[model samples]
Target chain A: MDGEQQYIKNVDADAELVDRARAGDLAAFGELVRRYESRVYRTARHILGNDEDAEDVLQDAMLKAFQHLDSFQGQSKFYTWLVRIAVNESLMKLRKRKTSRTVSLDENIETDEEPIVREIAVWDDNPEQRYSQGEIREILDTAVASLKPIFRTVFILRDVEELSTEETAEALGLSVAAVKSRLLRARLQLREKLTRAFKRKGDQILGYV
Target chain B: MVTCKDFLRELGDYLDESVDPQVREELSKHINECPNCWVVLNTTQKTIQVYKGMDPEPLPEGVHDRLIGALEKKIKSQA
Candidate 1:
Protein backbone atom coordinates (compact mmCIF):
# COMPACT_ATOMS: atom_id res chain seq x y z
CA MET A 1 0.00 0.00 0.00
CA ASP A 2 1.06 3.54 -0.61
CA GLY A 3 2.02 5.85 2.27
CA GLU A 4 -1.15 7.93 1.81
CA GLN A 5 -3.19 4.74 1.95
CA GLN A 6 -1.53 3.75 5.24
CA TYR A 7 -2.05 7.20 6.68
CA ILE A 8 -5.83 7.02 6.40
CA LYS A 9 -6.50 3.29 6.68
CA ASN A 10 -4.72 2.86 10.01
CA VAL A 11 -7.42 4.03 12.39
CA ASP A 12 -5.27 2.96 15.33
CA ALA A 13 -2.57 5.41 14.29
CA ASP A 14 -4.79 8.38 15.09
CA ALA A 15 -4.77 7.73 18.85
CA GLU A 16 -1.29 9.08 19.53
CA LEU A 17 -1.98 11.99 17.23
CA VAL A 18 -5.15 12.79 19.11
CA ASP A 19 -3.19 12.68 22.37
CA ARG A 20 -0.63 15.12 21.08
CA ALA A 21 -3.35 17.25 19.58
CA ARG A 22 -5.20 17.44 22.86
CA ALA A 23 -2.00 18.62 24.51
CA GLY A 24 -2.05 21.73 22.31
CA ASP A 25 -0.02 20.37 19.43
CA LEU A 26 -1.47 22.19 16.44
CA ALA A 27 0.81 20.32 14.10
CA ALA A 28 -0.46 17.00 15.37
CA PHE A 29 -3.99 18.24 14.80
CA GLY A 30 -2.94 19.20 11.29
CA GLU A 31 -1.65 15.68 10.80
CA LEU A 32 -5.01 14.34 11.88
CA VAL A 33 -6.66 16.58 9.28
CA ARG A 34 -4.29 15.28 6.64
CA ARG A 35 -5.43 11.78 7.43
CA TYR A 36 -9.18 12.45 7.29
CA GLU A 37 -9.69 15.56 5.20
CA SER A 38 -10.36 13.61 2.01
CA ARG A 39 -12.86 11.33 3.68
CA VAL A 40 -14.63 14.15 5.48
CA TYR A 41 -14.64 16.26 2.35
CA ARG A 42 -15.97 13.44 0.21
CA THR A 43 -18.73 12.62 2.67
CA ALA A 44 -19.84 16.21 2.45
CA ARG A 45 -19.31 16.31 -1.30
CA HIS A 46 -21.36 13.18 -1.84
CA ILE A 47 -24.13 14.35 0.45
CA LEU A 48 -24.36 17.89 -0.82
CA GLY A 49 -23.86 17.09 -4.54
CA ASN A 50 -21.67 20.15 -5.12
CA ASP A 51 -18.20 21.36 -4.28
CA GLU A 52 -19.02 24.84 -2.99
CA ASP A 53 -21.15 23.64 -0.09
CA ALA A 54 -18.90 20.68 0.54
CA GLU A 55 -15.85 22.95 0.81
CA ASP A 56 -17.68 25.06 3.37
CA VAL A 57 -18.67 21.99 5.38
CA LEU A 58 -15.13 20.60 5.25
CA GLN A 59 -13.66 23.77 6.73
CA ASP A 60 -16.45 24.06 9.28
CA ALA A 61 -16.29 20.41 10.29
CA MET A 62 -12.50 20.45 10.64
CA LEU A 63 -12.56 23.69 12.59
CA LYS A 64 -15.28 22.33 14.83
CA ALA A 65 -13.35 19.14 15.40
CA PHE A 66 -10.31 21.16 16.33
CA GLN A 67 -12.14 23.51 18.72
CA HIS A 68 -13.93 20.61 20.40
CA LEU A 69 -10.94 18.30 20.66
CA ASP A 70 -11.31 18.13 24.45
CA SER A 71 -14.77 16.56 24.24
CA PHE A 72 -13.63 13.57 22.20
CA GLN A 73 -13.98 10.66 24.64
CA GLY A 74 -11.67 8.23 22.77
CA GLN A 75 -14.09 5.36 23.43
CA SER A 76 -14.74 5.12 19.72
CA LYS A 77 -12.24 5.28 16.90
CA PHE A 78 -11.18 8.85 16.22
CA TYR A 79 -12.15 8.56 12.56
CA THR A 80 -15.74 7.71 13.39
CA TRP A 81 -15.92 10.73 15.65
CA LEU A 82 -14.60 12.93 12.86
CA VAL A 83 -17.09 11.35 10.48
CA ARG A 84 -20.00 11.91 12.84
CA ILE A 85 -19.14 15.59 12.94
CA ALA A 86 -18.75 15.79 9.18
CA VAL A 87 -22.02 13.95 8.60
CA ASN A 88 -23.89 16.28 10.89
CA GLU A 89 -22.36 19.28 9.21
CA SER A 90 -23.29 17.91 5.82
CA LEU A 91 -26.88 17.33 6.89
CA MET A 92 -27.06 20.87 8.22
CA LYS A 93 -25.86 22.11 4.84
CA LEU A 94 -28.50 19.98 3.14
CA ARG A 95 -31.21 21.59 5.23
CA LYS A 96 -30.09 25.08 4.32
CA ARG A 97 -30.00 24.65 0.54
CA LYS A 98 -32.15 27.34 -1.08
CA THR A 99 -32.94 25.40 -4.23
CA SER A 100 -36.43 24.49 -5.25
CA ARG A 101 -35.34 20.86 -5.36
CA THR A 102 -34.64 20.08 -1.75
CA VAL A 103 -35.44 16.83 0.00
CA SER A 104 -36.41 17.04 3.63
CA LEU A 105 -34.60 14.74 6.00
CA ASP A 106 -37.93 12.97 6.59
CA GLU A 107 -38.98 13.11 2.95
CA ASN A 108 -39.08 9.46 1.93
CA ILE A 109 -39.49 7.33 5.07
CA GLU A 110 -43.00 6.29 4.03
CA THR A 111 -41.39 3.57 1.91
CA ASP A 112 -40.59 1.91 5.22
CA GLU A 113 -44.17 0.68 5.52
CA GLU A 114 -44.32 -1.23 2.25
CA PRO A 115 -41.00 -1.54 0.47
CA ILE A 116 -41.06 -1.77 -3.27
CA VAL A 117 -39.82 -4.93 -4.95
CA ARG A 118 -39.23 -4.46 -8.60
CA GLU A 119 -38.14 -6.78 -11.38
CA ILE A 120 -34.45 -6.34 -10.68
CA ALA A 121 -32.01 -6.51 -13.58
CA VAL A 122 -29.20 -8.89 -12.92
CA TRP A 123 -25.87 -7.20 -13.55
CA ASP A 124 -22.64 -8.68 -14.84
CA ASP A 125 -20.79 -10.50 -12.09
CA ASN A 126 -18.01 -7.92 -12.04
CA PRO A 127 -19.43 -4.70 -13.42
CA GLU A 128 -16.95 -2.53 -11.53
CA GLN A 129 -13.93 -4.09 -13.14
CA ARG A 130 -15.35 -3.39 -16.58
CA TYR A 131 -14.75 0.31 -16.09
CA SER A 132 -11.73 2.42 -15.28
CA GLN A 133 -11.59 3.88 -11.80
CA GLY A 134 -12.52 7.35 -13.05
CA GLU A 135 -15.41 5.92 -15.05
CA ILE A 136 -16.61 3.92 -12.05
CA ARG A 137 -16.36 6.99 -9.87
CA GLU A 138 -18.46 9.03 -12.25
CA ILE A 139 -21.01 6.24 -12.62
CA LEU A 140 -21.36 5.71 -8.89
CA ASP A 141 -21.43 9.41 -8.10
CA THR A 142 -24.20 10.03 -10.61
CA ALA A 143 -26.16 7.09 -9.24
CA VAL A 144 -25.81 8.24 -5.64
CA ALA A 145 -26.63 11.80 -6.61
CA SER A 146 -30.01 10.59 -7.88
CA LEU A 147 -31.17 9.36 -4.47
CA LYS A 148 -33.22 11.54 -2.15
CA PRO A 149 -31.36 13.01 0.78
CA ILE A 150 -33.20 10.83 3.28
CA PHE A 151 -32.10 7.52 1.79
CA ARG A 152 -28.83 8.86 0.41
CA THR A 153 -27.46 9.89 3.81
CA VAL A 154 -28.22 6.54 5.45
CA PHE A 155 -26.69 4.60 2.59
CA ILE A 156 -23.59 6.82 2.65
CA LEU A 157 -23.16 6.40 6.40
CA ARG A 158 -23.80 2.68 6.62
CA ASP A 159 -22.41 1.51 3.28
CA VAL A 160 -19.83 4.15 2.40
CA GLU A 161 -18.41 5.07 5.78
CA GLU A 162 -18.88 1.52 7.15
CA LEU A 163 -20.44 2.84 10.32
CA SER A 164 -22.54 0.43 12.35
CA THR A 165 -26.30 0.74 12.20
CA GLU A 166 -26.44 2.06 15.76
CA GLU A 167 -23.72 4.60 15.07
CA THR A 168 -25.44 5.61 11.84
CA ALA A 169 -28.67 6.10 13.75
CA GLU A 170 -26.95 8.18 16.41
CA ALA A 171 -25.16 10.23 13.77
CA LEU A 172 -28.36 11.04 11.90
CA GLY A 173 -30.73 11.11 14.92
CA LEU A 174 -32.58 8.22 13.32
CA SER A 175 -33.79 4.99 14.85
CA VAL A 176 -32.30 1.68 13.82
CA ALA A 177 -35.50 0.73 12.03
CA ALA A 178 -35.39 4.01 10.13
CA VAL A 179 -31.76 3.54 9.20
CA LYS A 180 -32.34 -0.01 7.99
CA SER A 181 -35.39 1.00 6.02
CA ARG A 182 -33.52 3.75 4.22
CA LEU A 183 -30.43 1.63 3.70
CA LEU A 184 -32.39 -1.22 2.14
CA ARG A 185 -34.12 1.13 -0.21
CA ALA A 186 -30.90 2.93 -0.93
CA ARG A 187 -29.22 -0.31 -1.91
CA LEU A 188 -32.09 -1.45 -4.03
CA GLN A 189 -32.45 2.01 -5.45
CA LEU A 190 -28.81 2.25 -6.38
CA ARG A 191 -28.90 -1.25 -7.80
CA GLU A 192 -31.65 -0.18 -10.13
CA LYS A 193 -29.94 3.07 -11.06
CA LEU A 194 -26.57 1.51 -11.66
CA THR A 195 -28.04 -1.36 -13.61
CA ARG A 196 -28.99 1.17 -16.25
CA ALA A 197 -25.61 2.86 -16.06
CA PHE A 198 -23.82 -0.46 -16.25
CA LYS A 199 -25.91 -2.11 -18.94
CA ARG A 200 -23.65 -3.42 -21.68
CA LYS A 201 -26.40 -3.15 -24.24
CA GLY A 202 -26.61 0.64 -23.93
CA ASP A 203 -29.72 0.68 -26.11
CA GLN A 204 -32.48 -0.11 -23.61
CA ILE A 205 -34.06 1.94 -20.82
CA LEU A 206 -36.67 0.34 -18.64
CA GLY A 207 -37.73 0.03 -14.98
CA TYR A 208 -36.74 -3.62 -14.68
CA VAL A 209 -33.62 -2.64 -12.84
CA MET B 1 -41.37 -21.92 2.49
CA VAL B 2 -40.96 -18.24 3.21
CA THR B 3 -43.06 -15.92 1.08
CA CYS B 4 -41.34 -13.29 -1.05
CA LYS B 5 -42.82 -10.57 1.13
CA ASP B 6 -41.51 -12.27 4.24
CA PHE B 7 -38.11 -12.63 2.67
CA LEU B 8 -38.10 -8.99 1.64
CA ARG B 9 -39.15 -7.88 5.10
CA GLU B 10 -36.19 -9.64 6.72
CA LEU B 11 -33.66 -8.80 4.01
CA GLY B 12 -31.70 -6.00 5.66
CA ASP B 13 -31.39 -8.01 8.84
CA TYR B 14 -30.73 -11.14 6.81
CA LEU B 15 -27.86 -9.39 5.04
CA ASP B 16 -26.51 -8.29 8.40
CA GLU B 17 -27.14 -11.78 9.83
CA SER B 18 -29.06 -10.15 12.62
CA VAL B 19 -32.23 -12.08 11.89
CA ASP B 20 -33.23 -14.88 14.20
CA PRO B 21 -31.62 -18.12 13.14
CA GLN B 22 -34.90 -19.60 11.99
CA VAL B 23 -35.81 -16.50 9.98
CA ARG B 24 -32.37 -16.34 8.44
CA GLU B 25 -32.62 -19.98 7.43
CA GLU B 26 -35.99 -19.33 5.87
CA LEU B 27 -34.71 -16.33 3.95
CA SER B 28 -31.74 -18.31 2.77
CA LYS B 29 -33.95 -21.15 1.59
CA HIS B 30 -36.32 -18.76 -0.09
CA ILE B 31 -33.53 -17.15 -2.03
CA ASN B 32 -32.20 -20.50 -3.09
CA GLU B 33 -35.58 -21.45 -4.49
CA CYS B 34 -36.48 -18.03 -5.85
CA PRO B 35 -34.72 -16.41 -8.80
CA ASN B 36 -36.20 -12.93 -8.43
CA CYS B 37 -35.34 -12.56 -4.79
CA TRP B 38 -31.94 -14.04 -5.47
CA VAL B 39 -31.31 -11.37 -8.06
CA VAL B 40 -32.40 -8.71 -5.60
CA LEU B 41 -30.15 -10.07 -2.87
CA ASN B 42 -27.16 -10.54 -5.16
CA THR B 43 -27.39 -7.22 -6.95
CA THR B 44 -28.02 -5.35 -3.73
CA GLN B 45 -24.93 -6.86 -2.17
CA LYS B 46 -22.89 -6.02 -5.25
CA THR B 47 -24.18 -2.46 -5.27
CA ILE B 48 -22.87 -1.91 -1.77
CA GLN B 49 -19.60 -3.63 -2.60
CA VAL B 50 -19.08 -1.35 -5.57
CA TYR B 51 -19.56 1.73 -3.42
CA LYS B 52 -17.46 0.54 -0.51
CA GLY B 53 -14.60 -0.20 -2.85
CA MET B 54 -14.58 3.35 -4.21
CA ASP B 55 -11.53 5.32 -3.12
CA PRO B 56 -11.91 8.75 -1.58
CA GLU B 57 -11.36 11.50 -4.14
CA PRO B 58 -8.74 14.09 -3.45
CA LEU B 59 -9.96 17.49 -2.44
CA PRO B 60 -10.04 20.23 -5.11
CA GLU B 61 -6.86 22.20 -5.59
CA GLY B 62 -6.14 24.75 -2.85
CA VAL B 63 -8.97 23.46 -0.63
CA HIS B 64 -6.55 21.88 1.83
CA ASP B 65 -4.35 24.92 1.86
CA ARG B 66 -7.29 27.27 2.32
CA LEU B 67 -8.71 25.21 5.17
CA ILE B 68 -5.41 24.80 7.00
CA GLY B 69 -4.47 28.43 6.41
CA ALA B 70 -7.75 29.61 7.89
CA LEU B 71 -7.35 27.35 10.90
CA GLU B 72 -3.77 28.37 11.47
CA LYS B 73 -4.72 32.04 11.31
CA LYS B 74 -7.52 31.48 13.81
CA ILE B 75 -5.27 29.60 16.23
CA LYS B 76 -2.60 32.23 15.94
CA SER B 77 -5.05 34.98 16.75
CA GLN B 78 -6.32 33.13 19.81
CA ALA B 79 -2.75 32.64 21.04
Candidate 2:
Protein backbone atom coordinates (compact mmCIF):
# COMPACT_ATOMS: atom_id res chain seq x y z
CA MET A 1 0.00 0.00 0.00
CA ASP A 2 0.96 3.57 -0.59
CA GLY A 3 1.91 5.99 2.22
CA GLU A 4 -1.53 7.52 2.62
CA GLN A 5 -3.24 4.14 2.70
CA GLN A 6 -0.75 2.88 5.25
CA TYR A 7 -1.33 5.98 7.38
CA ILE A 8 -5.07 5.39 7.25
CA LYS A 9 -4.56 1.81 8.30
CA ASN A 10 -2.45 2.87 11.25
CA VAL A 11 -4.99 5.47 12.28
CA ASP A 12 -7.79 2.94 12.18
CA ALA A 13 -5.75 0.53 14.23
CA ASP A 14 -4.92 3.24 16.76
CA ALA A 15 -8.58 4.21 17.02
CA GLU A 16 -9.51 0.64 17.84
CA LEU A 17 -6.78 0.49 20.44
CA VAL A 18 -7.94 3.75 21.94
CA ASP A 19 -11.50 2.48 22.23
CA ARG A 20 -10.36 -0.76 23.86
CA ALA A 21 -8.06 1.03 26.27
CA ARG A 22 -10.76 3.53 27.12
CA ALA A 23 -12.98 0.59 28.01
CA GLY A 24 -10.35 -0.54 30.54
CA ASP A 25 -8.41 -3.08 28.55
CA LEU A 26 -4.94 -2.57 30.06
CA ALA A 27 -3.26 -4.72 27.41
CA ALA A 28 -4.63 -2.44 24.70
CA PHE A 29 -3.14 0.51 26.54
CA GLY A 30 0.19 -1.33 26.78
CA GLU A 31 0.17 -1.81 23.03
CA LEU A 32 -0.50 1.89 22.58
CA VAL A 33 2.40 2.69 24.90
CA ARG A 34 4.69 0.32 23.03
CA ARG A 35 3.89 2.05 19.75
CA TYR A 36 4.49 5.54 21.10
CA GLU A 37 7.06 5.03 23.86
CA SER A 38 10.12 5.95 21.77
CA ARG A 39 8.56 9.08 20.40
CA VAL A 40 7.35 10.18 23.86
CA TYR A 41 10.69 9.41 25.46
CA ARG A 42 12.67 11.24 22.78
CA THR A 43 10.54 14.36 23.11
CA ALA A 44 10.95 14.30 26.85
CA ARG A 45 14.71 13.70 26.58
CA HIS A 46 15.11 16.66 24.27
CA ILE A 47 13.03 18.87 26.53
CA LEU A 48 14.47 17.73 29.86
CA GLY A 49 18.06 17.23 28.59
CA ASN A 50 18.63 13.98 30.52
CA ASP A 51 17.57 10.34 30.58
CA GLU A 52 16.48 10.00 34.22
CA ASP A 53 14.18 12.99 34.03
CA ALA A 54 12.89 11.97 30.62
CA GLU A 55 12.14 8.49 31.87
CA ASP A 56 10.23 9.93 34.80
CA VAL A 57 8.32 12.25 32.50
CA LEU A 58 7.57 9.34 30.19
CA GLN A 59 6.12 7.23 33.03
CA ASP A 60 4.19 10.14 34.49
CA ALA A 61 2.79 11.17 31.12
CA MET A 62 1.74 7.62 30.31
CA LEU A 63 -0.04 7.25 33.64
CA LYS A 64 -1.72 10.63 33.23
CA ALA A 65 -2.76 9.74 29.71
CA PHE A 66 -4.25 6.48 30.97
CA GLN A 67 -6.15 8.17 33.79
CA HIS A 68 -7.51 10.80 31.43
CA LEU A 69 -8.20 8.49 28.49
CA ASP A 70 -11.87 9.44 28.54
CA SER A 71 -11.04 13.08 27.87
CA PHE A 72 -9.19 12.25 24.64
CA GLN A 73 -11.81 13.51 22.19
CA GLY A 74 -10.02 12.24 19.05
CA GLN A 75 -9.90 15.69 17.50
CA SER A 76 -6.15 15.16 17.09
CA LYS A 77 -4.13 12.02 16.49
CA PHE A 78 -3.55 9.87 19.57
CA TYR A 79 0.22 10.34 19.17
CA THR A 80 -0.13 14.09 19.12
CA TRP A 81 -2.21 14.05 22.28
CA LEU A 82 0.34 11.81 23.97
CA VAL A 83 3.20 14.08 22.93
CA ARG A 84 1.42 17.11 24.33
CA ILE A 85 1.19 15.40 27.69
CA ALA A 86 4.88 14.45 27.59
CA VAL A 87 5.93 17.96 26.64
CA ASN A 88 3.85 19.47 29.44
CA GLU A 89 5.34 17.09 31.93
CA SER A 90 8.86 17.88 30.73
CA LEU A 91 8.19 21.63 30.89
CA MET A 92 6.89 21.36 34.42
CA LYS A 93 10.22 19.82 35.39
CA LEU A 94 12.07 22.65 33.68
CA ARG A 95 9.91 25.21 35.49
CA LYS A 96 10.73 23.70 38.84
CA ARG A 97 14.37 24.54 38.25
CA LYS A 98 15.19 28.20 38.86
CA THR A 99 17.06 28.62 35.60
CA SER A 100 14.75 29.56 32.75
CA ARG A 101 16.12 28.52 29.35
CA THR A 102 13.96 30.45 26.95
CA VAL A 103 14.96 31.64 23.48
CA SER A 104 13.97 35.12 22.38
CA LEU A 105 11.65 35.10 19.36
CA ASP A 106 12.89 38.60 18.58
CA GLU A 107 16.47 37.37 18.05
CA ASN A 108 17.13 37.86 14.32
CA ILE A 109 19.87 36.70 12.00
CA GLU A 110 21.58 39.71 10.52
CA THR A 111 20.89 40.16 6.83
CA ASP A 112 22.67 42.39 4.37
CA GLU A 113 20.92 44.49 1.70
CA GLU A 114 22.74 42.22 -0.74
CA PRO A 115 23.32 38.91 0.97
CA ILE A 116 26.79 37.42 0.44
CA VAL A 117 28.23 34.14 1.67
CA ARG A 118 31.64 35.06 3.03
CA GLU A 119 33.24 32.22 4.93
CA ILE A 120 30.87 29.29 4.54
CA ALA A 121 32.79 26.52 2.81
CA VAL A 122 30.71 24.48 0.42
CA TRP A 123 30.19 21.15 2.18
CA ASP A 124 30.34 18.68 -0.71
CA ASP A 125 30.69 15.52 1.40
CA ASN A 126 27.54 13.50 1.84
CA PRO A 127 26.02 14.75 5.10
CA GLU A 128 24.43 11.37 5.63
CA GLN A 129 27.83 9.74 5.40
CA ARG A 130 29.46 12.35 7.62
CA TYR A 131 26.68 12.04 10.16
CA SER A 132 27.49 8.39 10.75
CA GLN A 133 30.79 9.27 12.33
CA GLY A 134 30.49 9.08 16.12
CA GLU A 135 32.15 12.48 16.63
CA ILE A 136 29.72 14.17 14.29
CA ARG A 137 26.77 12.62 16.11
CA GLU A 138 28.21 13.83 19.41
CA ILE A 139 28.56 17.33 17.98
CA LEU A 140 24.97 17.22 16.76
CA ASP A 141 23.70 16.12 20.19
CA THR A 142 25.62 18.91 21.88
CA ALA A 143 24.43 21.48 19.35
CA VAL A 144 20.80 20.46 19.82
CA ALA A 145 21.27 20.48 23.58
CA SER A 146 22.68 24.01 23.45
CA LEU A 147 19.55 25.49 21.86
CA LYS A 148 17.19 27.31 24.26
CA PRO A 149 14.25 25.16 25.30
CA ILE A 150 11.58 26.82 23.16
CA PHE A 151 13.56 26.64 19.94
CA ARG A 152 14.92 23.20 20.78
CA THR A 153 11.46 21.77 21.35
CA VAL A 154 10.20 23.27 18.10
CA PHE A 155 13.17 21.81 16.25
CA ILE A 156 12.67 18.40 17.86
CA LEU A 157 8.99 18.33 16.94
CA ARG A 158 9.29 19.71 13.43
CA ASP A 159 12.66 18.33 12.34
CA VAL A 160 13.48 15.36 14.54
CA GLU A 161 10.00 13.89 14.94
CA GLU A 162 9.05 15.06 11.45
CA LEU A 163 5.72 16.41 12.65
CA SER A 164 3.77 18.72 10.37
CA THR A 165 3.80 22.41 11.17
CA GLU A 166 0.13 22.30 12.12
CA GLU A 167 0.68 19.31 14.39
CA THR A 168 3.68 20.96 16.02
CA ALA A 169 1.72 24.12 16.67
CA GLU A 170 -1.11 22.10 18.15
CA ALA A 171 1.26 20.04 20.29
CA LEU A 172 2.94 23.11 21.73
CA GLY A 173 -0.20 25.26 22.02
CA LEU A 174 1.47 27.90 19.86
CA SER A 175 0.39 29.70 16.73
CA VAL A 176 1.56 28.39 13.36
CA ALA A 177 3.46 31.63 12.87
CA ALA A 178 5.27 31.13 16.15
CA VAL A 179 6.21 27.57 15.25
CA LYS A 180 7.49 28.73 11.87
CA SER A 181 9.60 31.51 13.36
CA ARG A 182 11.04 29.32 16.09
CA LEU A 183 11.74 26.49 13.66
CA LEU A 184 13.63 28.84 11.39
CA ARG A 185 15.74 30.07 14.28
CA ALA A 186 16.42 26.54 15.38
CA ARG A 187 17.57 25.51 11.90
CA LEU A 188 19.82 28.50 11.55
CA GLN A 189 21.37 27.95 14.97
CA LEU A 190 21.97 24.28 14.27
CA ARG A 191 23.53 25.04 10.92
CA GLU A 192 25.88 27.54 12.50
CA LYS A 193 26.88 25.04 15.16
CA LEU A 194 27.54 22.25 12.67
CA THR A 195 29.39 24.56 10.30
CA ARG A 196 31.73 25.73 13.03
CA ALA A 197 32.45 22.19 14.11
CA PHE A 198 33.09 21.07 10.54
CA LYS A 199 35.37 24.03 9.95
CA ARG A 200 37.37 23.22 13.05
CA LYS A 201 37.75 19.63 11.93
CA GLY A 202 38.85 20.77 8.49
CA ASP A 203 41.49 23.01 10.03
CA GLN A 204 42.80 20.21 12.22
CA ILE A 205 43.00 17.87 9.23
CA LEU A 206 44.93 20.50 7.30
CA GLY A 207 47.35 21.00 10.15
CA TYR A 208 47.97 17.24 10.38
CA VAL A 209 48.52 16.87 6.62
CA MET B 1 10.78 41.66 -6.39
CA VAL B 2 11.59 40.07 -3.05
CA THR B 3 14.86 41.37 -1.70
CA CYS B 4 17.27 39.18 0.22
CA LYS B 5 15.85 40.51 3.50
CA ASP B 6 12.32 39.58 2.54
CA PHE B 7 13.52 36.20 1.38
CA LEU B 8 15.29 35.56 4.66
CA ARG B 9 12.23 36.58 6.62
CA GLU B 10 9.91 34.25 4.71
CA LEU B 11 12.30 31.44 3.84
CA GLY B 12 10.73 29.14 6.42
CA ASP B 13 7.24 29.79 5.13
CA TYR B 14 8.43 29.32 1.59
CA LEU B 15 10.11 26.05 2.49
CA ASP B 16 7.03 24.91 4.41
CA GLU B 17 4.76 25.79 1.44
CA SER B 18 2.80 27.96 3.81
CA VAL B 19 3.29 31.22 1.91
CA ASP B 20 1.00 32.55 -0.80
CA PRO B 21 1.71 31.14 -4.23
CA GLN B 22 2.80 34.49 -5.53
CA VAL B 23 5.23 34.95 -2.62
CA ARG B 24 6.60 31.46 -3.13
CA GLU B 25 7.15 32.14 -6.81
CA GLU B 26 8.95 35.35 -5.91
CA LEU B 27 11.14 33.62 -3.34
CA SER B 28 11.98 30.90 -5.84
CA LYS B 29 12.91 33.54 -8.35
CA HIS B 30 15.14 35.31 -5.83
CA ILE B 31 16.94 32.08 -4.92
CA ASN B 32 17.46 31.26 -8.57
CA GLU B 33 19.29 34.55 -9.02
CA CYS B 34 21.05 34.90 -5.66
CA PRO B 35 23.92 32.47 -5.08
CA ASN B 36 24.43 33.41 -1.43
CA CYS B 37 20.80 32.98 -0.52
CA TRP B 38 20.83 29.75 -2.47
CA VAL B 39 23.71 28.37 -0.39
CA VAL B 40 22.08 29.42 2.86
CA LEU B 41 18.84 27.70 1.91
CA ASN B 42 20.62 24.62 0.60
CA THR B 43 22.81 24.17 3.67
CA THR B 44 19.92 24.74 6.01
CA GLN B 45 17.86 22.13 4.19
CA LYS B 46 20.78 19.71 4.30
CA THR B 47 21.21 20.29 8.02
CA ILE B 48 17.61 19.35 8.70
CA GLN B 49 17.87 16.30 6.48
CA VAL B 50 21.03 15.10 8.19
CA TYR B 51 19.51 15.59 11.61
CA LYS B 52 16.43 13.68 10.55
CA GLY B 53 18.52 10.81 9.31
CA MET B 54 20.20 10.21 12.65
CA ASP B 55 18.87 7.18 14.53
CA PRO B 56 16.97 7.82 17.73
CA GLU B 57 18.77 6.46 20.76
CA PRO B 58 16.98 3.27 21.71
CA LEU B 59 15.22 3.22 25.08
CA PRO B 60 17.45 1.16 27.37
CA GLU B 61 16.27 -2.40 27.95
CA GLY B 62 16.13 -2.03 31.71
CA VAL B 63 14.13 1.18 31.56
CA HIS B 64 11.76 -0.24 28.98
CA ASP B 65 10.99 -3.31 31.04
CA ARG B 66 10.64 -1.28 34.23
CA LEU B 67 8.23 1.17 32.62
CA ILE B 68 5.99 -1.61 31.37
CA GLY B 69 6.15 -3.39 34.66
CA ALA B 70 5.28 -0.24 36.61
CA LEU B 71 2.31 0.57 34.36
CA GLU B 72 0.99 -2.99 34.67
CA LYS B 73 1.34 -2.89 38.45
CA LYS B 74 -0.48 0.44 38.65
CA ILE B 75 -3.35 -0.93 36.57
CA LYS B 76 -3.59 -4.01 38.80
CA SER B 77 -3.58 -1.93 41.99
CA GLN B 78 -6.43 0.19 40.66
CA ALA B 79 -8.43 -2.88 39.60
Best by lDDT: 1
Per-residue lDDT of candidate 1, residues A90-206 (tens digit): 877776675566656666547547567654666765665688778888889999999988888888888998888988887777788888888988887788788766654533323
**If chain B of candidate 1 is superposed on the true chain B, what is its TM-score?**
0.91
Query: Looking at candidate 1, what is the lDDT of residue A83?
Result: 82
Among all candidates shown, the one with the greatest DockQ: 1
Displacement of the residue A49 alpha carbon in candidate 1, Å: 0.9
In candidate 1, residue B23 scores what lDDT?
A: 79
After superposition, candidate 1 runs with Cα above 4 Å error: A1-12, A99-108, A126-132, A199-209
Q: Which ten residues in a row have the lowest lDDT in candidate 2 chain B?
A: B34-43
Per-residue lDDT for B1-79 in model 1, tens only?
Answer: 6887887778888888789998788788889988778877887788888899877777899999999998988888888
Error of 2 at A202 (Å): 8.7
CA lDDT of each prediction against the hidden true structure: 0.82, 0.80
The Cα error of candidate 1 at residue A51, in Å, is 1.6
Q: Each candidate's chain B TM-score?
A: 0.91, 0.87
